[model samples]
Target: MKKVAIVQSNYIPWKGYFDLIASVDEFIIYDDMQYTRRDWRNRNRIKTPQGAQWLTVPVKVKGKFLQSIRDTEIEDSSWAEAHWRSLTLNYRRAPYFEEVAEIVEPLYRNCGDLALSQLNRKFLEAICRYLSIQTSITNSWDYDLLEGKTERLAALCEQAGGTEYVSGPSAKNYLDPVVFKETGIELTWFEYGVYPTYPQLWGDFIHEVTILDLLFNCGKDARDFMKYTK
Candidate 1:
């Protein structure tokens, strides 16, 4: 049975995002959906000396409420340098930061993708590779997108030939099980917690931050951390 998940691309998402990705057989990037501002689509948190800080990519969403994530563009070309510097300054002292820096720094150096989806996809792909996650990644636009929320997800699962669908716990409020049952797909929600605190650079342990925190601190053992407790 193949497990599949459809999710909007996120900017250097947390460990849970990769946990879902690693748990599924095929991970679909639902970028065709409308881009919502101030979401994980283009920003995420990182631990800093002061506290947890948000690092957002400046995107041009001036007046386009209906703009799809695939069409959203970066507001300026300079955010890359600033973000890299911020990451460097905050995480430079973390264990294995230098090792991860060699792997991730080049992504900032060659920033050519202007679209938010494109940027998120590139980073997600690289991070997955680093974590040794072999799940196949695809895009929502590649399939026939249906109309409603549950219908769209069910149809995408069918198109992807998924026998099971894995979802984040947040979707429990809106995801209708009947829709997946109609499509002959088993639905399961991923629950977070049971994350053991590792060596953090900051004063206290923060569970919710970008996956970079795990990678920089844990290094090659990052996959061990992404395996959420059952």
Candidate 2:
């Protein structure tokens, strides 16, 4: 009864993202697809004294055409330091900032990787450890990728030895149920809705900020807030 999820790598994504990871037995970094700009692939939000702000990593795909997420490259080495500084500046006062910082700060400083997917995976794996999520994660490129939308996803799940597929809500758009049914695999959808708010600093609590907001504010208990028993 193995459950699997496949999603593009996101840069320090929101708590909901981690919740999906925690819910499954295997989580696949499906970054072999085309990269989209102004998406969570390279940027995410963090709360500030004034309001929410985006911390984005500049990529070198402006002139290049049809770059896959795994192939996307960071424009320069400076984004890491700047992003780390921004996080420290805004979240320095958070209740558990220092705790999470000690574990995550070195990632920013030591990032010599050029690929966006590699960097995203680095941060994601580190944060998953901090949250104690032990789900087995692998890259999609490691598998024999097929063509088409749902077919590729289903192929990846099957390659990962998954009996059930847990997908994000947006997959309802083009995910063909017939494919799963014919393949004798169960397909389930998970939505990150109405997240319970925890004690947050700065101002009114914002729910969609990066999971770092939850980690900095809730510390080790952040997992309790992000996941449910049911």
Candidate 3:
């Protein structure tokens, strides 16, 4: 049975994000949804010597509170250099830092003036490839989107020929199971259970940081620490 997952694109998301992508047959970037400020949509955490630090992509949010994620533009191109500097300064000592930097540094250097959704997709695709995740990635706008929260998700799964829908556990609060039952699609909650600790650089390991942490520390063997990725 084909499994599908619909989630908003995130900037340098954590391992669990990629885990979700790898768990599915088709992973849809649901960027058509409204953009939320200070969310994973444009920012994420990175481990540092002091503590977890945020690496946020500054976006133009003034007078545009209701813009979709696909329409959210980057506020300044300088944010790229700044973010790259943070990654380098913090993860320079990581075991595989140089190897991972070869793959990620260029993405930052040439980020250019792109929408937040596009930027997030670029990083997501790169990380997926690094871990050999072959899941088919698509945009939400590619489908004829319907109305209602659960209705839209269930319909999208159906349109994608999905026999099962895999969603993050957060949706348990609002996702209506009846919708999936009517569509004959089994809705399953994805659990970000206790992940195995890797050779992290920092004193205390933090899994909430970006997947870059895993890449910088483990390089080609990163998949061994991840759940769904082969």
Give the TM-scores of the predictions, in the order they appear: 0.96, 0.97, 0.98
**Residue pairs in candidate 3 whose N, alpha carbon or C atoms collide under 3 angstroms:** none
Local lDDT at 192 for model 3: 90
lDDT for 133 in candidate 1 is 86
Model 3, runs deviating above 4 Å:
none
Instruction: List model 3 lDDT by residue over 1-230, tens digit each.
Output: 99999999999999999999999999999999999987899999998889999999999999998999999999999999999999999999988999989889999999888889999999999888888999999999999999999999999999999999999999999999999999999999999999999999878978899999999989979899989886
lDDT of each: 0.90, 0.90, 0.93
In angstroms, how far off is 129's CA in candidate 1? 0.6
Q: Write the per-residue lDDT of candidate 2 for residues 1-230, one digit (tens) a residue.
A: 99999999999998888889989999999999899998999999999888999999999977777989998999999988898999999889888999999988999888886689999998889988888888999999999999999998898888888999999999899999889887878999997878788998788988989989989988989866876422
Q: TM-score for model 2?
A: 0.97
Query: Which candidate's TM-score is highest?
Result: 3
lDDT score, candidate 3: 0.93
What is every candidate's alpha-carbon RMSD to the true fold?
A: 1.5, 1.3, 0.8
lDDT of 2 at 108: 89
Comparing candidate 2 with candidate 3, which one achieves the higher lDDT? 3
